[model samples]
Target: MEKTTRAAFAFLLAACAPGVFAASSADLSVTGSITPSSCIPTLSNDGVIDHGKLTAKDLGRVTPTLLDLAEIQLEVICEGATVFTLTTFDNRAGTSAINPAHHGLGMINDDQKLGSVAFTLFEPVADAVPVKTIVSRSGGARWAENAYLGHEALTSFAAADGPNTPIAIEVLNARLRAFTIIVPARDLTVLDEVPIDGQATLQLKYW
Candidate 1:
């Protein structure tokens, strides 16, 4: 009887050992290609839009004040012909007095919202050929002309013949226009000198 009991215990241990020690495995794949061509993007004036200064008298009391339009030159040069897109990120996010699609101008006293700015691309020239500005909200799947440049949209230049398709180019030049609007004076505290702190990043991506 002792031998039989010992044999039964050994069988139980053997059956449970496989279940406890068994390992499950999965495979992971890391794959991507490095392109030989690269592109460099630069903006005129070091990408700075100085609004100088603003006083309470310059701002509106009940309506939003519209500042003068600002224009900046954008250039993208590539080692070789390459397809790319341009996007923007609002550094002062969540501080825009207008809609979220617009870039923020920062806040006052860490509570009161300041203003907003909207960017538009115009007169794009790629490889010395005139091209139109095309934008895609669906991650390059589809593109259209005359779309607003926002954080969620991708901006690219299309050849004149191909109105909605992006083309590879060695160089691109475009005008970036910014329209700014300040919040109403009634919604802000103008007791002190408040700086119009607005910053944004224009990013380039390979397609």
Candidate 2:
């Protein structure tokens, strides 16, 4: 009986060997594009939007209060006229529990909800031409106008479609309408003054 059981166990081990249950391989269709020139993008004041010092009392006791609008001049200087669009990576991702459009203000911890900031992109001009912002969710065959640029189709694939016409630009200019909103004072546990640390990275999506 023991020899029979051992034989069965050995058979099971052989069936479960490394190559016995191999996963089927699938083809990885790689695709990419090569662009001719590059661009140097910069923001005014090094892209810093300072909210400055704000007392807890300055924040509303209950309702969210909007801070003064901070502006950062957006400019992209290119080697030649090239098609490109911009995308934003939330530096403080997942910290914005309240709003998706609003980038995060760093938390005090896991529980305490900090504040949020939302910005708008406007006045886009490329190569001295008013290159109005447009989006194509339909694989670049058609494009519809889109003013917003927070992780929408404007920033995803359409921005980098070289074969299809992308936004042509040797130089690009735009303005960020940034507004910081402070949470209600009572919602936070105030042992001392806290710094509002909010950040995001704007990437130039190109082909």
TM-score of each candidate structure, all chains considered together: 0.87, 0.75
lDDT (C-alpha) at residue 72 in model 2? 82
Error of 2 at 94 (Å): 1.2
Model 1, 166-205: lDDT tens digits are 8898999988898999999999987788988889898998
lDDT of 2 by residue, 14-127 (tens): 778968775668799989988889988899998889988988778899888889998888888988877766667888887764577778888885677688887676777666
Instruction: Output the TM-score of candidate 2.
Output: 0.75
Displacement of residue 79 (Cα, Å) in model 2 is 1.5
User: Which residue ranges in model 2 land beyond 4 Å of their true spot?
Assistant: 1-27, 135-143, 152-165
Clashes of 1: 0
Looking at model 1, the pairs that clash are: none
Full-model lDDT for every candidate = 0.89, 0.73
Q: What is the alpha-carbon lDDT for the whole of candidate 2? A: 0.73
